[model samples]
Target: MSTPVQLYIYDLSNGLAGQLSLMLTGRQIDGIWHTSIVVFGKEIFYGQGIMITQPGKSHHGSPLRIVDMGETAIDEDTFNEYLSAMREQYTADKYHPLEFNCNSFTNDCMGFLTGGSIPPYVTSLPSDFLSTSFGQALQPQIDALFTGRPPSGAPARITPSAATPDPALAASILQSVTAQATMGGPGPSNGILSMPPAPPVAPAPVPPAPSLPAPDASLVSPMHITTNPASFHNLLSSHRAVVAFFTSATCAPCRMIEPVFGELAKSKSKPDGGVGFAQIDLSVGLGGALAAEYQVHVTPTFLFFLDGSKTHELKGVNAPELRTQVDLLIYEAFPPHAHMSLSLSALEAIPLDPILFSQIPNLDTMFTKLAGFIDGVTAWNGAVTQAQVKQTLTRTVLPFLKASTATSPAQPPMASFDHWPTLTSSLIANLQLSELFPLVDIWRIALLNASFSAWNATKKVQEGPLNRFMDKALQAGDVPRNYLLTVLRMLANAFSNQVLAREVILFTRERVTKLLVDALLHDDVTVKNAAASLGFNIAAYLQKQRIDKVKARDDSQSAEENEEWETEIIVAILNAVERETNSEVTVHRLVACLGLLLRLSPYTAQVTSLLEALDAQRVLKGKLEKGGCREGGVGKKDVRRLILEVADKLCPDMAMAM
Candidate 1:
């Protein structure tokens, strides 16, 4: 009889690796992976050399993820014999974390029992880590740990044998095991090893959500240079709000408050469409013509415009009044969302950063897979096309990404990307949906660079490569789960750039909303997790807009879209919460999204009604009682806090009535 086999993946640093790797090692590593093999009701791993325990109950705690390695037809007796041999080869003294560690053992065991290999991302991590400068600097420490001497008072290290297993027997085992094994390599070669540290308090497996950078006023000059009448006219017509400082160089008062006006321009001008600042020198070129046109008779006169028409005026250097009127003008222009007044501390504390998939995969294999797909496209010459894509990935994309991941004080110079969008867009247009994931994943990783996303967002909606990819992936009736997951991740990473976020929320809202809602309800835990992430990104964007009191240039359209999708999103989250019983991470993400969607929403009454109708309190209460989000059979305090805030906002009277 065949026995089912599973690969349990854990993060040794818990989530600290993802949160700190970029700062420490100059890379965005998501996890420091540790793997173990499970079969015949026992979990087998090599740490202090070949330990056995109940699945997910080892000192490592629960796994971050589990992979199905297919069933092994090797009988229990034969598997035991294999383990007996493995025990001698994988002793405590022979362990080194990088050269030969748990992943190496699992790779060997899986090869023997099921003729399979673990995922490349797991196996290639050590090399990728060492590629960084900080990682290189730690080499002496790594060597010290792996030397023949064990820790003080510990037994001397044992040397592993470099013996080969029977090649013919391995081939026979491959035929006996399931046919899913795709890669081949020997296991348990002689190498140094060291035990992992006691696992840290477990958090989410991936990187912590990234906080959005506060808007920097230094991004634009303090005021527009109005050199001519036409230039002044253009400035007024272009901006939603304009505060033209009619000042003469000769006036001491104008000089005194000039700095104050510049400060205002920096703070209030960037949030929404921005308040335009123009200095009309009256003593300079065409300043007299512009001054006469606006009927400004005094030096240091402040004229405010809303939609190109003058609405308010102030004289002299009344700094306090300038501040007040600017705030008033912004409020009039954008109008804060109604729920912004409520006291919701829990929701406010939650970070509004984008959830990113920043782990570096095997770049060579990724390019090879993409090249294979390109080769099959009949419209292009395969070799020429592959060379083009390869040149971009090798010469520009990979090197730039590696440098950016460093802990450097300054950003690396960006390469010319004139060909990237066109090349990637053409691939999306031509490749089959099943074969498009590799390219999409490459794009997703690149989107982590703000410059890349900003450039992509500059493309017209029709010509945008990301838009084309989204349409192909989401619009296709039945996307493979892997492809869909990558697409969802790509959208989440899109939030790294504000322009991309605007395009996603404002331009592609409908299709993106449907994809998120459907994926949240997907049966697979991973798929549902990815969907929850995308949902969180959407909710975060909307909530930030509301909190900042910023609106799109077309306020009516943006507000109407928010109103349209508000209920649908809330309903999907509530349903997912009720259905989710396995993953605490997914549950937490869903709850966060729910809270973001509810807080500072314009349609408060409608959402409250919908939540009440859906019995949202009951659903959330039931989730709190479930086992996954609860470790050691107790609810997480953070999850419970979010639920309470969401429940209070939606069904305030439920507690009293109950």
Candidate 2:
């Protein structure tokens, strides 16, 4: 049977009086106030996080637009899984006004089930939001609101139960949920009509009768009460998400809801289990401090926490209310994985160089000057400062290229040189000034467009500027981390070409690989991020070089030398991935480069034997599984699937180990 998919779209601008907003000199509407995606026939709405509801009403108006996205791979089981997974990630604490929101969530779902994507226009709202002057002014407020800091500007006026929302604040509050939209349920994990996953708590010693007003102890997790305010506060902030219940021993409602709360906790059975159920007794010795901090005037209060921030609260004995929020807690607790499928290659791929370099007219002069000093950079004398390079590029390089582009769109100017030098005496003198960041940036761009093949190929001149740079970089004391970062990116760019990459690999005797790996673990985040991208470039060039090597080598006698070289590069990449701590994009890129290297070709057997000792999947599976199918951000899903796809090809029989 073909399962149908439905999309629901809501306009955030629905109730706003546009006439007043138009009267103002600044913003017209609060922001792009809309949300959507109808998957699996049900109106799958993800505002505060993913949820499902009957199609009778949408907060804006019953969907301004709906698209039938054909069929779903949606089995009832997978549908439930998607919702359960969606619920976990769509929680208020995890919601970012721009980065991860309803629109992003819908795209994730569409991509997972249909191998389809959300329209670019809808998904581009965050960037669009960021591009505006009003967005810029309101950003700190929006960022603060989502991240648990007090909102600064207009957002400061909004509250959890506001009847009407300011346009911009409303977008920030897009993930905000209301009791009316949700109604009462057992909780997020269980429904009044649907069964929840089984509880993970050990069974209570005594079983209660079905007629009992309270649940049997075995049915619920044991509740712990807080006695220490400082420690209690610390405890609450430590967990990614938690449920804190406030009760007074003398309060009748507190006693009444106690049993139901147990049943509520029992309903949680996610992999990491359900939300933590803890109580704060306002009647205890430290009650005053706790009560004052949270303003607990009533009994049976509940607070929802995700990522060390309290997102929502309720004061009541409503069992269904607690259950509904609990469902949200479960969803936030265990985010769903977007399973990447790679039958052959990625369904979506980014262009090799998505960023086009701008024109520079002084490129020819820059090259002439740089190449002149390649032979004796250390011996030569010259003024080395950021100004010289900037003045040179601004005066000569950029204008010439700009004129060329203006004159002939078909022929953009390229850097032509008999020899490509990474640095010169003039370059080295300036680079040593320690704070020359601007010069480094300009040099990087200049090198990016360099045509190394323009050199006299007949002489096969082997040396370049890096022959000098290695000494200077290795001897330098700690400088501003970006200085090294600029160098790393320049090196990475050099690795874009196979001929240059081969020469680099042999000349350094693999020290370049080691240097790149060292940078991956650098203390600065920028350096670490740069090093990650650098690894991708190296592996890409290596992949290309490997293809060429296979065509040229047919002899068995040189197997050891070939094995040693390829094995070193492969191990460096694997080690880089294993040590990678920051930037998940880096990890994905590194994995993609590895996948390219690992792809079995006509002559991979000789080098493949060397990698057999390594446990390829263990190092990578932990990262990919941890990612759990998130989309965008360096195409995490695509790279992950490609890794698996190539891994399967490389190790066809080691299915169990992988």
Which candidate should be chosen as best, given TM-score against the real structure?
1
lDDT of 2 by residue, 112-154 (tens): 4565555555655554544444344444444554445333211
Question: If scored against the real structure, what TM-score would every candidate get?
Answer: 0.47, 0.36
For candidate 1, list the clashing residue pairs, or say none. Answer: 26-405, 26-406, 26-407, 95-192, 95-193, 95-194, 96-192, 96-193, 96-194, 210-353
Give candidate 1 regions above 4 Å deviation. 1-341, 376-386, 406-415, 475-477, 550-561, 626-634, 652-658
Worst 10 residues of 2 by lDDT: 195-204
Please list the C-alpha lDDT of all candidates, in the order they appear: 0.69, 0.51
